[model samples]
Target chain A: MSGRNATIEVGATSSALVALIRSEWGKAWSVRAPAACLAGAVLLAAGTAFTLANDQVRAMQTGEIPVGTLVPVAEILASSVMFAQMVVVLAALQLVTPEYASGQIATTFLSHPRRWVVVLTKAAVAGVLGGLTGLLTGPLCVAATELALGDAPRATVPAAEAAVMTAGVFACAAMVAVALGFLTRSGVAALSVAFVLLVLTLAAPAATGKVFPGVAGSALVSGTGDPYARWAALLVLLAWVVASVGAAVVSVERRDA
Target chain B: MRIDDRARRPAFRTFVGTGRQSGPVIVVPMLQFAEISKRYGPVTALDHVSFRVEEGTVTGLLGPNGAGKSTLMRLLVGLDRPTSGSATVAGHRYRDLRWPLRVIGTHLGGRPVHRRRSARAHLRSVALTHGLARARVDEVLELTGLADVAHRAAGGFSLGMGQRLGLAGALLGDPAALVLDEPVNGLDTDGVRWIRELLRLLADQGRTVLISSHLMSEVQLVADRVVVLGGGRLLADTTVAELAGRARDEVVLRTAEHGADDRLRALLPDAAIRPVDDQCDDGAWRVTGASEREVGLAARGADLTVLHLARETADLEAGYLTLVGDRGQQVDSVEAR
Candidate 1:
């Protein structure tokens, strides 16, 4: 009998982790919604930055504000990261929820029975794509704001720090979204929690609420003079990502697919 | 003890430590359920079920609704774990296999593709994990007759096309064993015949094929042996020939005269006699518990003129109903030859 026989060899040509990474990458880009969301994230960030700078410049021209008011171009660009971050959240949330909705999660489990490996790789992929979106958007928004504020008096030219902050925050936010996706396995449930954290309870002014993603993101993006607050905000965002992704991985290992 | 066995243990039992558990090596069956049981809080889905599917043959896991057929197949693929016993493929759990898709192809139903994702994209995603080549994906698409519509979104596909896509995914790795659940659920007649022939060819090429369905007629044409399940319990392990034979054993006879029924019963006193249809006084009658030979010989021994003599061939649905004791079950069609 040829129970193990085949017309062609079927062994793996790559390591398990590499195959998992490649698979997750394919899954992330295969759907039109995630790609659309990522594009929206970039456009929103750049467009918002352009509009803000253009409005500030126009207000100065109209004499509504004082002529010598200091303008922070980098801060204006980084501020738009908050709104586009929601699009990144939706895009990252997609990496986990579609499989569950289409019942393809079962196929994922079947293709690779190691649940932890699959979950972790998925989180990593979503994180990278989300980070890349922010990485490009951050610099693009900076450039767009610069274009809008042509010849305006500038307070600081810290585009590098602002871009890096945008990238780091967006990456961490995506990991949290992917984690939420796996934790809930339902779009409505995950999106509802996302809304509560990102929109509803945003900046509750409470110490605990400061740890919420939206609050931390708002505080971080708004910080201009104090470097310490920015560091604190970054730490809180990282903590959220670590905790959310950790719980999701454990749930996958313990629960049935 | 100075053992004289210099040969590498028996072929059936090989000692190895790279698979499932490390305590001892377990003998591998193509597909085996060793007293496996599953429960969902208060309900037992499978009760100490034990069965084995051999190589180069197609085995049908026959059962009605809630008979645990899907659960058993899921257990085999490591989709669901057994509460106590083990369900292994080739002496290893599905999760234990370094490359599972190469060993066992799985196609559980109720799974659909992302609506906006193309068919090629769906298969490619699965193949990417297995490190299978893009050529392999195209090969499967061609093999399943989906190459023409490979670029179409699966959401727009018809029922038959969807099933073909599922099978394409299963065959991506060219696994040795194929485990499918209700593979013919929404298939047309052509789809049904196509799958039947495909399964036969796969088994003929030395692959173990196990399919589950509630409609016995679905498997009547494809399966060689059927492992019947009822209420999550094993009811019968028999050949398709045995199940199909239920449609036989009674002979139909027609006499030249309308009132020859009494003479026929008198001639074959040991046989149970009845009319083919009671509404009409036609000369046709059904004789049970007797072969065509006995009826013919009895009629010849007497002066009875026989117009028509033939053995009865009924549908397997009646036999399945009798075996499962579920008269409310409905079969899609009666295809007995």
Candidate 2:
């Protein structure tokens, strides 16, 4: 209410999307749920890694399995991703669901009239934060597991592929959550949909898992069986991301906030 | 074509009106709603409603519950697309503007903030969108008297705090126009007074402000112009004085002489005069279309000794209720949709 002049300086071309992403970035970190998810993922990752590697080492000592059994470091991290995946999904859902539930989305649409930009920027923020969660937790989990191994031969491509593959899958899952958040526009409903999809993907056999909703990001880490290879798996994941983001854009633009 | 950075900064350059009133200059409206119609399936929320709020005025969007007041404000901010026509800020459709918040600030009902985000964080998030300076957050926080609880999470805020936070968000861009719906919903007396003065000051600064509220008394005190909607139709759009003038000025008088009623009626044949009767009072008369002084003068001219004469005080609430009698009921059905 101060009589100060309304002196705001803005440039048109690069302002909307760039400023949105920048604003969304600060928003992602400032909220509690996302930061809490990241912290919980890191804690659970380290715990899972240490326990899995220790169990393997103890099995060798007891001759329950052969000694020098190469600890599956990548497998341990992948399993950790599965455990933390739901948390990541919920966090991503928080990106937009809370807004809809509280009716804050109207203000957001009011802020940026072009609905697509807001939808895209939210998905991007979720994807980046989800990817960051993977990048931080994956290598650290591998490090924890390897530290427990103590010269035990590390097995498979997991040593080299753990961080990037986990990041790809986590990032895609987060994007999917963001898209579903817009599609459902309710926290409970979006989380339920995301949960059911995750369960279907996880419960499927390896042969059919590659075709499921989230298997591509996982298939990116390990390998898809027979007919569909890693590259095709990537395309599948990209297709889901594209379709989700597309639906989100349509929901926000074609329908009321 | 490249435009100078500073010239394009406010995001919308005010579109001057070629429309001339009586003077050399024409008053350009900052907010315009032209034939805006919105329907959710069969229910028409707003039906071809059109009105414009001129710059430097606090226009009240007044209506009863579900009177399409909020619906119109929603359409104005592009929260919901109209089935036909357009609502514009600064002479451009809301969606077409590149930096909308820099041109018009809106608060539908607070930002619906995340429970965990602090007030400062919430303001900063909005400020960052327009690349507004960080100090703008503190300035608005202080302006809304939220500087004390700026760092607290919004989850624990009371209704008044939440409203103040919403106002803080709306002011982040220092936009040229503000559209607020039910801005005083939960505010205490002090908060209500603060916002009233705030709206007054903002309008005084040549900023266009449109506030939607069902409280006729509040709108009467704060708004210069009112655009009243009833049952999804435009009912009244005029200045506060003009709207109040819509009511009939009544002069009630009792004469000392019992036969003066007949003489006064004969003296003023055109005025709507009726005797207030309970079968006993024959001298008391209610005169319409004339002030108390006029009524007394006419009685004197007729040699009717007047014992009592008083005019009923006119108020906006009475005028507003009379304007939309029994028609505002349709708003409830449409809102149910």
Best by lDDT: 1
Model 1 misplaced regions, further than 4 Å: A1-14, A58-65, A225-228, B1-26, B214-218, B245-248, B253-286, B293-309, B313-319, B326-337
lDDT of 2 by residue, B240-272 (tens): 988787777678998887757667777677788
**lDDT (Cα atoms) of all candidates against the true structure:** 0.78, 0.78
Q: What is the TM-score of each candidate against the true structure?
A: 0.85, 0.84
Residue B146's lDDT within candidate 2 is 94
Superposed model 2: Cα runs more than 4 Å off: A1-12, A54-71, A147-160, A205-208, A224-228, B1-28, B252-309, B326-337
Q: Output the lDDT of residue B218, model 1.
A: 69
Which pairs of residues collide in candidate 2? none
DockQ of 2: 0.39
- CAPRI band for model 2: acceptable
User: Candidate 1 residues B119-139, lDDT tens each?
Assistant: 999999999888899998998
- lDDT tens string, model 2, A209-239? 7566656655566553333666886788888
Question: What DockQ does each prediction reach against the true complex?
Answer: 0.42, 0.39
